[model samples]
Target chain A: MPVSNSLRSLLPVLILLVLFALVPLLSPSNRFLSLAISAGINVIALYGLSVLFGQTGILSMGHAALVGIGAYTAAIVARDFNVGFWLSIPLAGIMAAIVAALIGVPSLRVSGHHFVIMTFAFGQLLSIILTNGGDYTGAASGLDVQQPVALFGLSMDVLTHYYLMVVSFVALSAIASWAIINSRYGRTLRAIRENEKLAASLGINVGRHKIGAFVVSGIFAGVSGVLLAYFLRHISPSQFASFPSIYLALMVMIGGARLLLGPLAGGILVAFLPELLNLDPVQSRILYGVCLIAVILLLPNGLIAGIVAGWYRFFDRRPVQPNEPAVEREGK
Target chain B: MDVLLQQILNGLSIASVITLIAVGVTLIFGLTGIINFAHGEFLMVGSIVTWLAVSNGVSFWLAIILAMIVVAVMGFALERGLFRFTLERPTNGFIVSLGLIIVLQHIVILFWNANQKSIPRPLNTVWEIGGVRIASVRVMVIFITAAVVAMTFVAITRSRYGRALRASVEDRDTAALMGIPVRRYITGVFVLGSALAGLGGGLLIALFPITPFTGGTMVMKGFAVALIGGLGNLTGAVVAGLILGIVEGLSAGYGFSGWTDAYSFGLMILVLLFRPNGLFGGTSGPKMA
Candidate 1:
């Protein structure tokens, strides 16, 4: 934990952020920049997911509902209370966290299979409720956010400005996620994930810690949701349905949920892979399904984890334990 | 009173179909420890096949049989090719099933457009009893489901294979050590479960219009029934399914149609909170790890 060691550990993240910062300077087309901005927002949420799935070993199949809650909170607050974008960001996150805690409390009591099913049901329930919300929820056709995000006398209506804002948030999220993963609480979650009974025997409050992980992830999803609302200027219940949750889960799984760079890599790859391949939405989804199966079977940790292990094997000539902490593996 | 009776009858028919799907889900989970998210997709495929067969001039009953066979074969293939590899980790099996949901749904969409498809009702007759009218097709579905459930119950309780399946469900390792072919039993249960879902699908299209996306909603309801009945408990599924169908029927009939789905989800959450092991608490499922 020396200053030099801390800086060394942050080197990769710093390099990655610099590259992200240069995207707009590269003079990419607006369409490409928009896609990058969307991906950046997803990366923010994925970092939260990594802490839950990667560190705590709990996969929430209803994460998109949490995101939807955030998005809807922002829209409602802006419409009803005349809140601005800046205030709505924190408001949305808090709203999502509160809902996450409510669902997580009872859901955490069940076993893994039941938990997954419960979350899936909850996602469906949220969408259905939204669709039946009548005037309050705009009833299914969805709500439009009329207010544009303004910062320090500068309008973020331009694509470049919005992209930078999203990128900065993504960077902040990555740093927060990195800090969490390296903290004592992260290690406790990891210990619980490895062996809940053993961790409980050692005086760890397993249930509280698990719920805490869910809330943390929920906050990330909420912030991502606000960014999405402002970026698209519209939000719908369908966008945050069970399939989107599955989509988010798929990206995290494919990118190596345990790795620090996994979310950024996963977000960009999933967003652009179909475009790059010139495939239709259905075709891309089929490909994703195949990729997920292959990853789970052959590379249980994910794409980046597999590559990192291979790199270590090839260069360092040392056998990396499959369960070795990802940060330590990278630091070495 | 007549409307109440009619709703109750309608509820029974709905419950029958739900029971078929829920029992299949429970059976597979009991033996394999894998919650097949694609089980509803199997049902969808079955309904599609039934529609194809009936449109191509096959008898409705014969078409149902054909669909069951086709889906059973698919179940066997998946068990051998995909699920067999994930036995060591049930969570992996679950993920693979999620993958299967995407693959199967899109494949269906590619072959047949995403529009809703319906089959002609073979029995258009309506029987009126005590001022309550019931469609003959509904009665047929109820009778067929009841017969299937009875047969399944007898098989599990009286037949040699039933005893073996029960033993395996109770303790897979011990069952395997006792000269039981646990692997083959797993395949058998999976295939049987898939076939049951196919039968339910065939019956479902007779009652309602279906699309490629119907699996998502169907699976949710099926899980609700299965879990509420106590996962891995067949009797629990039937009773739970009956209760769910009746409640849904009354709710929709009484002008709460917009929130019919929400009721099921809310009921499921409440059950999970109160009885995490399910209402019947007769799970042969694995211990929480």
Candidate 2:
């Protein structure tokens, strides 16, 4: 407990400083830069889902809808109005957050399997609307986003996008992970996850907390989507299909849903595994299924959780000192 | 009047297929609380197997029987290899099933290609009555579905195996305490459920082209039907399937063919919002146990 307390006390500041120093140097090559960029986007998106799933215990099969909303918002603003990238990015994220809140209103009424169905339906409906929205959404052909413009005299390029994504992903994941574990709000959310009625009896407004988490999750997903749109310079309904939501869920599970960096670890593993294998789309999906099953069966606590716990045990081998009450309390 | 009769007949044929699929899904979910998304892939496999068997000169009925047996084996293997491992963690079980769906669909694509494949029509007659036109094949489908449903009803309500399965559904631990072999019953349900799915696939081949991607639509519709009737409710699945078939038929007839897919999902969302327990399925309340 004392060892863990000391590590926890220093982790945040260490992580932030390390990330800030390492991000700019991450562009080893164009391919590496792109993978890093995409991984960052995935981390941002899964951050939202993790809060809902890990914290609030609501499984949303439609988190991609928020991503799609953000992507489309950026696409529409950039392509249609020829707006600046800086202006459109925030606008898109804002629009996605708002849409997520609206859908969350109805979704907050249900939880567990019922919530899963609602989110799945919402995602499907969004896809249908986007596909059939005709001229506005470019119909089934999808929308084409222009390359982002120069900001602060720095040209928009692969390296720039990669660094930007890394900054956003690390910044958001850190805040969200810290906020959930350290804040009273996080305590209430976790309590609701453990037992809704019990949490309610403890004077927590379960419904409001659920909606709040949903909204916050949506904001993270929106930011991810906006970055993704810029990275690809094109957005399509097909890219944000139901399957992506499933993949996100798989990533969360594989990374160990209970941990903050779980999504990042899971996302990178899943995303890179397929590319590394040079698998076709169908084969990739099949591998994902197989991988998911293996992970669930062998490592239910997820890859990161198992590793982190193992690392903690291996390093902190010393027995507790009797005079370490303050350290013990912090650890607990 | 003629159009109405034809539409009604069409509705019945579709409803029968849905009943086969939904009841299978409902039975498994009812007994085990495992939402097997891969259930539709069983149907897909069965159809392709029957197609292969029939093309090789096997009799239609014989091909169907063999396909059902094969799917039953696959179901058993899946249960032992995957589902059994995740019984204590149902959410993980769901993800596992979903993964299976992807794997199975890809396997289909590998063998059958992505193009649509059609089974040779074994029955080519059209039967007309009361100004209604029904394909002889479709009538056969309706008859087969009715017979299966009737047989299942008797088995569930009257047979010893049915009693044990029901007891297991009510309470697995208590059923075990009461001398029921819960594992055996679950294995039996998985086999039976897979067979029902195989039968549905065989029947569906007569009405629609089989494509590698066909399982997703069927799975979604089946889930919607199960949700509509309430989770694990057999009779609820029947009524709900029929209602869904009719709604789909009418939607397609009224020139909203594109929205036909949306209709079931829309209905499911409404149900989740208004009656999470389902219409006749009776209290699908989350099992905290």
Q: Point to the candidate with the largest TM-score.
A: 1
Q: Chain B vs. true chain B: TM-score for each candidate?
A: 0.96, 0.95
lDDT of 1 by residue, A249-268 (tens): 88888888887878888888
Clash number by candidate, in order: 0, 0
* B1-289: candidate 1 lDDT, tens digit per residue: 9999899999899889889999998888765677788998999999999999999999999999998999999999998988887776666777788888998898898888889999999899998888999899999999999999999989988999999888877777788899899889989999999999899989999999899998887777788888788878889989999999999899888998888788778888778777876788767365322
Residue range A197-271, candidate 2, lDDT tens digits: 899998888878888888888888887887788778888887776778778878887886666667767878887
The residue-level lDDT of candidate 1 at A34 comes to 89
* Model 1 chain B: ten consecutive residues of lowest lDDT: B280-289
CA shift at A181, candidate 1, in angstroms? Answer: 1.3
C-alpha TM-scores of all predictions:
0.95, 0.89
iRMSD of prediction 1? 7.0
TM-score of chain A of each: 0.93, 0.84
Model 2 residue A161 distance off true place after TM-score fit, in angstroms? 4.1
**Once superposed on the true structure, which residue ranges of model 1 sit more than 4 Å away at CA?**
A1-9, A319-332, B287-289
Per-residue lDDT for A279 in model 2?
Answer: 92
